[model samples]
Target: MYGDVDVPAAVQRALTGFLDLQQERLEAIGPELTEQVQAARDATSGGKRLRPAFCYWGFRAAGGDPAQPILTAAASLEMLHVSALVHDDVMDSSDTRRGAPAAHRRFEALQRARSEVSGVGGDPVGFGVGAAILLGDLCLIWADEMLHTSGFDAAALARASKFFDAVRVEVTAGQYLDLVAQASGVSDMDQALRVLRYKSATYTVERPLHIGAALAGGDRRLIEALSAYGLPVGEAFQLRDDLLGVFGDPALTGKPAGDDLREGKRTVLVAYAVDHASEVQLAEFDRLFGRPDLDDDEIQLLREILQDSRAVRACEDLITERTEDALDALDRAPLADDTARKALADLAIAATSRQL
Candidate 1:
């Protein structure tokens, strides 16, 4: 089986080639739309492309070739993800992403520069956020278009499209639940896991695998098996991401340290920390958890508390357990090809083991 960071060279080359083709297609859409499309497409530059890789391998596992149309459709899903992130950052008002200025922030700077040149602008940040939203919407439309034109059979197209649509709804619902949970200070670990499963796992991993399998005309058994593997891996992936948000090196992650704390994300890790902390630690956490004025020293102290309380260790143990379950699922899955199965296993490790 492939290990973490051991993506096959062929897969890497195919993905790169697919991205180039998609970028060209995005740029050729129209002059008026080209700039926005390009901006949206460029926003994908820094991501790990895990979803598209999953789709590609899932296709292979279901007995499909990694050729033009299949790979193109797979790449389109990446664009869809990128579009979601662009809009999400705007909505979250995140200043940085992928260790640099977020798309909205970049666009805000552009708007300010244009305003200075043309003598027009009330609030550049607002204008930029609006523009980024529109651009994200455009990318979503084009993602569907690309999928439609991807040369799959009608049945395959319908199946994949249906899954993709369902993913959108599930993810949106998850996001809604996440916001509600955070606002209400509902720290139930079970509720937090549900939010993670629906919002992060189903869409990020399970549905994408199912979509790929559907495109290749896989049976229901195979689809269910893929989901079985995907759910745990996907949840683990997001859980690792939450850890990174607080403890990850800012240079690697392309964001300020303790961003999740600043945003007050009600992740499972945070909930566990709260549950396990002492009265003194709880007092400190309550004072600083959602405070925007937290300094580096305070964040460091919070990290220490999380470690001393063993929440970090507990979270890591959960990640390992989930990953092992995913691996076991993959092992028992009736994959027709060994290479594809190995690739999928490798992907799970990479998704969960990243530091950034």
Candidate 2:
């Protein structure tokens, strides 16, 4: 459902191989560590593999071959993404992910089960949180290791590493900004967009493209062009995600509806609603928008306010505008491979389409 590049299978194979090897290594150190590795595997499994799709097609666009090294390097993005998701779930105190118990939640359940069987007293919640943090850190470390061992030429790996490192720093900073915005309860679109760009745009698309291009020894011109196309599409992807958080079906999204509202996301959709809401609507918004105990009826009420204020429609327009801009940039990207260009074109639509 992504780039139509037939690479998801290959990416999955590569990821499985790496995880298997890492699990063996972990077992050698201590069998008790198996659960952490299993958690990593669980976090890495499923999802769209969008980051790897972006990286693989980016490499192909820059004339990289469908070789092992490129595929392995592309698969490394999944590791980094897993690290983010595990930590993000912990930070959000989310109970579920990908339609299953979140990492911390899973750990918490395990702790509870052990306590019940052993009749022992312990801090199950704290243990779960601590274990999840270490698991997240392990994923981060392994992601770097995977990239370095991906079999690319040393020179190429070095070049790609720069972008890879930048993505980590930028995403961390973006997460910090998001936390700040939520804490301050700011409703400014500018702050929301800033957080969006740093938290998601670069990591999801721009730097992945850059890393892929660097691995292929692509020149500065190609890297810049890919960035031009990636950034806006990335923004559109996140905007659509914000919409889905409130309006999407749980069956499709693997999340409860209005979870973002309960978390006080401070997304652009909320900002628009705040700006456009009438007195009565604003009063209702203030009452139900961010309450942890927000009920289904209140969610429906907020949805009505968002719709009546045209925030949802305005966000849809922005998504469409950004998608068009991304396609236009793709057309002018100077890619020599027609197939690569077409794949990226398909990806732009997939990235921001309603079905996502």
Candidate 3:
């Protein structure tokens, strides 16, 4: 979508350089660890690179130099994102990511192959999950290493680290909250929105921009402007994602249709459905929404209920409102670079309007 964008390319190059150096370091440690390093490489592959773009543009809009250090720092966000995704796939028991085998699934396949050759029986599932967890941990560690060693001045790095650290803490907390929300099966829209704010909104948009602004030595005013813009935009982004998880084409979304329904996510859409559904619709919904074995007919029924309740339309309306708010915030902010402002506007559209 952003074929003309130079910043995503710069971010990708920085990521590649860092991962290549990491692979070399692992090779020096021992050839036995080669496959794990390769798994790390695979897990980091093929994303929209949105977090890095947010960071890059935030810095640029603040009159920060488009230099290697800032680019490297921006790319570090991708590493952190990868870490979250790897662990997320594991936690969600997802089989695929980026239209390929997830990290844990790949490790499972490797373990199975080894066992077949050795004629031994073992818990491939346990081994795979363990390896994937360690790989995710390594990605987080490398993210910190990349930012600290990006050649930014110590003061800038220190300042940026606060946002970065908070991102880690908040996202982790949000993940735990999500697990609890799922287990408890809460249906309140406000409660669901709180999960969205921490699990996705902050880490996805707010903190990346905050980290960039801090690195640029931006004032409190600029940071506040960015928060105003980022929070709503990020919420819209995740709202779009929730819609896609249920209704998106697998070819476009890189996941099965109705995946979110199967997972029993207590999203705002589900909450709205519960509030507006008829008794019969609610009964059917309770039976089908979380069924791991949901068939196409069952999935279609749930989709119909969501539509009948106008939950889908409500979610769409919220997305539009949030997006407009983000643009309004952007317009009011005293951004130094017109190009950066335009880029951010384009990003807001792309983030909310994407099919994938």
Candidate 4:
């Protein structure tokens, strides 16, 4: 009851219980699936549970009472999130997630070791990618199953299904947009911001809140209010993530320093730097911006180019602006629970200012 609505541990317990049951089902299939099940577990375990927290608080703000049913429903979002992370890492070819090998990489390693021991020949990369995609698909399936079976009555499930469906579609669309942006090799601010809005903003915060509000029978006005508050906050949160990807410490961020720099992500931060860079700075930027083999010094040089261009400052400004917009909308929202409103306000600050 974290002060009124959200309970992180309860969310974790709900997810753990579900995963345990699924693990049993997987193990019964064959011993070869043992590693796969563990990988799935690792993908889902440990996070701030921010989406669940937001959804739970959204329910409270809509005048719903604290109940166990909401926890299971909210925890299902974590499964969906795991699906996103697994697929995103595969797409990015990211080696690590939360300081561990990303799911595809883990799968690749497992298959590689098995093939060597068995003297069986297979494409390790293909095996890893295929397995990771299956893992993501399983998680996606479980997310819907967990939500529908969450002890909510039929009406509540029906009410929330629209938003739930929307989240899935919006996030996938956002991922596609992001992929296209990368392929186009353009760093226009508008394109970057558009991708951020869909990829992170809507699905990460706004839709989950909508799902919760719908479950609680919140009116259309409240849903509108949540959208006003959630979308900007979500954008700010991802903006902070963009900064962390470039400038954060590996220890705190749970990835290599400048992970995005190595990936050559055409984030708004990169766009800003490109826009403001001097000819000499642009020369250096062009030379070292996207090389996957960026050494420590090269990353530092890239950092210098961004900082010198005031791109970091530009991103900081955007985060501050969007967060303020979210808070203002929250203040004006007609929430029944003062406590939930306060919790969300604090969350906005912590989320944008977070080091991880």
Candidate 1 local accuracy as lDDT? Answer: 0.79
Reference-based lDDT, each prediction: 0.79, 0.88, 0.89, 0.90
Q: Give the per-residue lDDT digits (tens) of candidate 2, residues 26-63.
A: 99999989999888888887888788888888888888
Q: Taking the tens digit of each residue's C-alpha lDDT, what string does model 3 give over 1-356?
A: 33235766777788888888988898899986788778877766677888988988888778888754787898899999989998999998988887888899999999999999999958899988999999899999999998998889999999999999999999999898888878886578878898899999999999999999899988899999999999999999999999999999999888889989998988988989999999999999988888788999999999999999999999999999999999999999988788889989999999999999
Return the candidate ranking by TM-score, descending.
2, 3, 4, 1
Q: How far is candidate 3 from the true structure (C-alpha RMSD, Å)?
A: 1.4
User: How many residue pairs clash in all the candidates, one count each?
Assistant: 1, 0, 0, 0
Instruction: List the candidate 2 regions with Cα displacement exceeding 4 Å.
Output: 1-4, 354-356
TM-score quality measure for candidate 3: 0.97
Question: Where does model 3 exceed 4 Å of error?
Answer: 1-5
Q: Candidate 4 residues 1-72, lDDT tens each?
A: 355544678887888899888889888998787776688778777777888888988998898877549989
lDDT of 3 at 122: 84
Residue 293 error for model 2, in Å?
1.0
Error of 1 at 217 (Å): 0.7
Predicted structure 2, TM vs. truth? 0.98
